[model samples]
Target: MKEIKTKIIERIKSHFQDAVERDYDYNRLDFSVKKETIPSILFYLKDEMNFKHLSHITCVDWLEEKEFEVVFILWSYTDRLQVYVRTRIDRDHPVLDNIDMIWRQANTYERELKEMYGINFTGLEAPEEFLLEDWEGPPPMRRDFDTREYAARTYYTRPGREDAQDVRETIIKRTGEELPDFAKKYKR
Candidate 1:
């Protein structure tokens, strides 16, 4: 696995002229490429390197960096390897070339990205609302989105909610067993 990943990184570095920043860990190779070069790089990997399966597309809003990181996970059946092709685009104008022609399933992930992150895929058809209906504000997935504030504004909560106690704390006081970190975040 390590040898294959090393070879793939070497091939990309040689062909793409140091266009990618390579990272390997946990048996996966991640290649961070430029937004403009991602489509061609992915096409080459798919056609020549046998990375045929488009596993999924993930988007990360880096509010501090003022950019959005888009990752395309690809799987190779023959090599039994996974490659993550990542690129960063301006958060304000997040647009990229659509790869729906390369992989049909891309539309689903692309549409989700569009709906969640306000990313626009130039060549893809305009996507309808996926999860949010008549959403009028900033993309909820962005870091700047204050979910607690949004919930308070969008939904009607009972009065005196500010004095609510943590449900996990009450449970721990009774049971003498601590709740997991995730459970501790919610209040009664």
Candidate 2:
């Protein structure tokens, strides 16, 4: 494991000078690189380094920093290794190259990110609406999106069901079970 990790680190550093490698967990490594180098690095890892599996792709909105961190998780079945390719893009203009060509499943993840985070994936060929249906609002997954406020404005109570029910109280009534003192704080 150590030898493979060392070789991967050395190869990535030699090929992509801007890549910064770190070992934060057992059998896992993180490579932070410039957003522009994402496609090339992913291609290299998949084609050359035997990291053939694209496990997941996720995004983190850094509202304070005005950036969005995109992470591509890859797995190597043969080596039993996990690698996270991370990059940050400007929040104001969150545009990134579409890597669906490298992995077909990437199209689904990219489409979700495009709709949820407002991150534009240039050249991505997919439906405009991925998860959300008939939605006309700011990206719901973004950190700055106020879910409570949105719910208040968008949802309304029925006349017969106007009162909100407390789940904990309802459960206690049905089961005759008293919650612990510490858990009582979570009561509605």
Candidate 3:
């Protein structure tokens, strides 16, 4: 454990000059860096180090701080190791430079974030509609998109057992068992 920690710290320091903080939890290491340093850090990890696989790119909407943070999870196939790169951006005009230069496949994830989270990835080939076709209002993934209100307004929910016939009441009456809650309530 001690050796792994020492090696991971040494590796990050040796490989990435701009890594601001090293955080570890859930059996994975996280590297936080300035958004501007992303291109350099990604280049170093992809080309120099063995972080050849980009598992996924995700975002955390920190509404309280009014910033959206992006995370890129990278994997080393050879060492079976993983690392995360995280950066924060202002929420008012949440925009980020595309990581397509480092990982061309990052475009797909970026597009999803653009559609779902409304975080504009400047210069990416974003189409008009992707996840939600013709979304009329605020992006659903943002902290402000009130899901309950949205569902009440736009979503159609199928009536469930609450909307069922009084089958339970009928069964209770036929069997002469203690009246079911539904039957008791209906009697009142």
Candidate 4:
């Protein structure tokens, strides 16, 4: 198995002559493939290399770098070669050829990345309906997507008491019972 991994890596390395493979934190080998080679690499994996299954496609919105890093993790039941093909793209206009042609599973994952990262899937079917149906805010998975800010804007606070007063006050109002100090701290 390890021999196959080394050989497959060697094979792909020739294609991506300038690419860099590193041991990323999470105990996964990471390959920083070029933006342009992404489509070809995926096709090679699916067709010639026996990686028939595309596990997932996702992106990291590196706001600091002003780039969005894309990840395509591929696997196969036969040879069991798992490799993560990665590339970086401009944040403002993250356009890439859709890999749905290579793997049909990429369709759903690309759509997910489209909504979650705000990264365009080029020519893929992803309407802003359902799931994130009313999401008019920043892409939720992006580094800049602030949950607190989103909550403030999208969520409505009801008139009923929620963190309006302490639990003791609410209990006193509802049950008309006084909670002893020590027990009050422990009880909900």
Candidate 5:
């Protein structure tokens, strides 16, 4: 397994000199590359290497860094290995090339990322809405989107629950036990 990993790492590094090898284990490897090299690297891995399965595509919102990390995970049944191709894009102008032509399932992941993370996948032909329909608020998955604030502003309180005591207070009262100081701050 170690030999296979070393060979794969060498192959990738030799082909893409800028590719940075990141954390890995016995079964997984990660490579960080510039956003522009994503299409070529994925093509090389899928065609040259035996990584034929597109496991999934995910995004991470680095709020403090003002960037978004887009990760493309792939799997190889023959080698029993997984590779994560990671790239970071500017949060203010998140744009990426659509790779649906390489793997058709990429459409679904791209659509979800487009709707949820505001990522514009150039040439991705999909419906405007994937999961969220008629959503007027900011991308809900983003770290800047406040769930509590959105709920309070968008939803109305139930007619009977307005005066309801905090659940913790009720539990403490019924059990005749005092809540710890840390739990008291949650009282509304």
Candidate 6:
């Protein structure tokens, strides 16, 4: 496994030069590449290196850095290895080249990313809302999204039960034992 990973790293380094940053963890190899070269690198991995499976696509919102990290997980059945292809794009204008043509299943993942992270995949066909319905305001998956505030403003909360009491107070009163910090949040 390590030999195959080393070979792949060496090949990518020789071919793409400084355009990629490589990291190895046990049996997984992670490559951070520029958005522009994503398609080409993925093509090389799929066609030449036999990384035929497109496992998933995920996004991470780095609010402090003002960037979005897009990850493409790939797997090679023959080599029994997993590779993570990652890229960072500007959070304000998160646009990426579409790889749906290379991997058919990528369209669904891309669509989800678009709906959840506000990422636009250039040249990819826009699908209807994947998981959200009539969603207003910013994307819900973003770090800046205040879900609690949104729910409080958008939905009505039922009144607490008449029997409800602070669990901490109840525990202290009954057994003379104060509830731990973790148990203090719940109502009895």
What are the per-residue Cα lDDT tens digits for candidate 5 across 11-113?
A: 9999998899975587999999999999999999999998999999999999999999999999999999999999999999999999999999999999999
Model-by-model lDDT, in order?
A: 0.86, 0.92, 0.80, 0.77, 0.92, 0.86
User: How well is each residue in 102-167 modelled by candidate 6, as lDDT tens digits?
Assistant: 999999999899988999999989757778999888888998999878977998856773334455
Q: How close is every model to the real structure, measured as TM-score?
A: 0.83, 0.84, 0.76, 0.75, 0.85, 0.84
How well does model 1 score by local distance difference test? 0.86
Per-residue C-alpha lDDT of model 3 across residues 1-188, encoded as one tens digit per residue: 44654676687777667676565564477888778877788887788677899999999999999999999999887666678889988999988887887788898899899888988887888666877887788888998899867986887766773434567655766897787565566762
- Per residue, candidate 4 scores C-alpha lDDT tens digits across 30-95 of 678779888887787778888887888878778889999999887777875567888999998988
TM-score, cand. 3: 0.76
TM-score of 1: 0.83
Question: What residue pairs are clashing in model 3?
Answer: none
lDDT of 5 at 156: 82
Give lDDT: candidate 4, residue 69.
90
- Give candidate 4's whole-model lDDT: 0.77
Model 2, 18-109: lDDT tens per residue?
Answer: 99999978899999999999999999999999999999999999999999999999999988999999999999999999999999999999
Off by over 4 Å in 2: 157-188
Off by over 4 Å in 6: 19-24, 161-188
Question: Which segments of candidate 3 are over 4 A away from where they belong?
Answer: 1-5, 14-18, 23-27, 156-188
